[model samples]
Target: MTFDVPDASYYGALITNDSFEILVRKNANTGEGLFLRWPHDSDTRPDLLVQSCLDKEFGVNAQLIEGYDAIVFIKGGSLVNFIVHYLGGDIEAVGLQWVTLKTAWELVFKLEDHEVLLSDSASLGVLDRWIRNRRRKIAEESFDGEQKKWLEKFDRLCDRVRYVLGRDSACYGGDGLYSEYIKSIISSAISTMKEQEDLDLYLNDLFGRTSKPGRSAAREADLIQAIHVSLALSSLDLYNAEYTNHVKECRRVLGFLVALENIYGSSSLEIRRRAIEGGNGRWRGHDKAGRIKSDQIKVGQVKSIESAILKVLEDKKLYRKSDRVDVIAGKIAGAVQGEISTLGLGDFFVDKDLQLFIWHFISENKVARGLIK
Candidate 1:
């Protein structure tokens, strides 16, 4: 029952890494003619096709992680399956440039014309799926190089605070210790303000007096909590909070953490915002705009998803030929919204796509598939 379109189909490779970067070969510098040119042979299985494309394109070995018919192109109504691959650090191949996912998306949207060999859906869907599924992982790894180095510096400062506090354990061993402990530290700073200028400034900052007013309370809470956490890390024998360079170091650390907090929204909100505001303005795993196609859940495979979808159809008696297709699809989509949102598919799946997919699946039993026209 293959349609009379081009006998050619396409297979694409989506190379990604732990650092949230993707490997892609740009068409000149415009990134138009993307996706590896895959030879279609009926005898060739998907895994073999992926491996062949990888070997031919990158001249490197690839371990196939996952594969899916991620999109259907309208040009020839061809279904494109993108194979997701995780490249090892040992890659020495030339031509393939590694770019961050954000850069990759930017390149994708900049295309004014689609390539004959490359389907826009294949490119967009694969990238979108990866981003939605790995948003948190991406954010966590975003702090790898310079950010990690700075964070480690902050950690060392907190460690110093812990060591100083550990020197005086006897006084802080009783109940209501923090109240007395912090007060004693403050009293020491005030009484010796002239002798320990750094300690006095640190104490003033610690007590929230030095900070500018009307800052975000949530962020301020995070800074205060971090200080409390450092203090809580260890309790030793110390007469008072010291006036060493650790004071300035601690202040610097707090400022860095607060800056990170503001940008990342505790490292979660910014990612969510980007996911929503990025390409299509929908957060796939959390929003209703995401889609799930028939290929995403093949018949009789992925029973959890299949059964869930079918149950919705059955509950509304939408399986009957007499039922209206639009009503049936809408009901099914709404009913399975919760399940679909958790399936890690990107937000590209809309109600119209779900309706079409339903009609594609059950039209034989109810109405003719041609009726979709």
Candidate 2:
């Protein structure tokens, strides 16, 4: 099923269970006319056509249609059956419907008059504020619940792994002994801080201490735990006290592990003599240099983590802003600039019209991403 579309033009195909629509537009920058309608409709609505496609399915294929003309496709009748038979499923159909909905929504909202009305209306101010606050609360509660669940699962894993390491002499013998010994030490430390009150005090003390390099590591652990708890609470909104308690307990365990790691290096020299003389004496002189090196690698892999975290925070801020759409558009503009720079196009022509064109494309894409929610 295929149809021929012109070159150097943008085409959007919206296929549904019963009907299909195809729209074709000239250069998105030149304010050219658009042709749109159901394939069978001879009298189509030219005014309803959009300058750019806003569907996620279509936006994802932006590069494919960027400067191309002509699209060939067959819609209706056995076309869908052919699609299902050829593709082996209806996932693409679902995705296409999602894009169609988004495209329709964008067409309604992107009107110049609607933009003016939104900008000039005083009542919209109060409505926007109320919506923002409501959304923030919902996001926070959702996050809390998710955080609690994740923390409980993480704690259970830590406990099980620690127990296995403690009992399995065969697996932890030789060079893996140091990791096992550190695990034991951490497990013991965690046992000592059984209560949340004790754990909180320990974390606060570690946060205040500055004399030891170990304190820096401990402080980082505490900060990371706090951030994790905050994000989880904000994101998950877990109402179960058991889950929250388990998360707190997991934080305690992580703090203990960080402290133990700080005390024990990768060498046998770092292990206490008493530990070597214990029943696990056969595992003495085991090295953990590789484990330490791996941890170093993880710590060094910061760029992607930082970028993702910052993006999340920026998105949250945008959502919280009074003018979320505008703020997001600004972010998208900045993102486009950064992307262009990465492509070595920073020195290219700095045309306002071209920049605006790119910004529109990015903003439409962002809106499409949001609609997936």
**Top of the candidates by lDDT:** 1
Off by over 4 Å in 1: 1-8, 28-32, 74-79, 88-93, 114-118, 135-373
| TM-score between model 2 and native | 0.21
Model-by-model lDDT, in order? 0.44, 0.31
Distance from true location, Cα of 297 in model 2, Å:
24
Point out where model 2 deviates above 4 Å: 1-89, 93-218, 230-238, 241-373
lDDT per residue for candidate 2 within 254-297, as digits (tens), equals 55444433433233432322121221323334343421223232
Please give the RMSD to the true structure for each candidate, in Å.
Answer: 19.4, 20.4
How many steric clashes between backbone atoms does each model show? Answer: 13, 30
Lowest lDDT 10-residue stretch of candidate 2: 78-87
Across 236-293, the per-residue lDDT of candidate 1 in tens digits comes to 2121223244345456545544542343343343232322122112332334324343
Each prediction's TM-score against the native? 0.35, 0.21
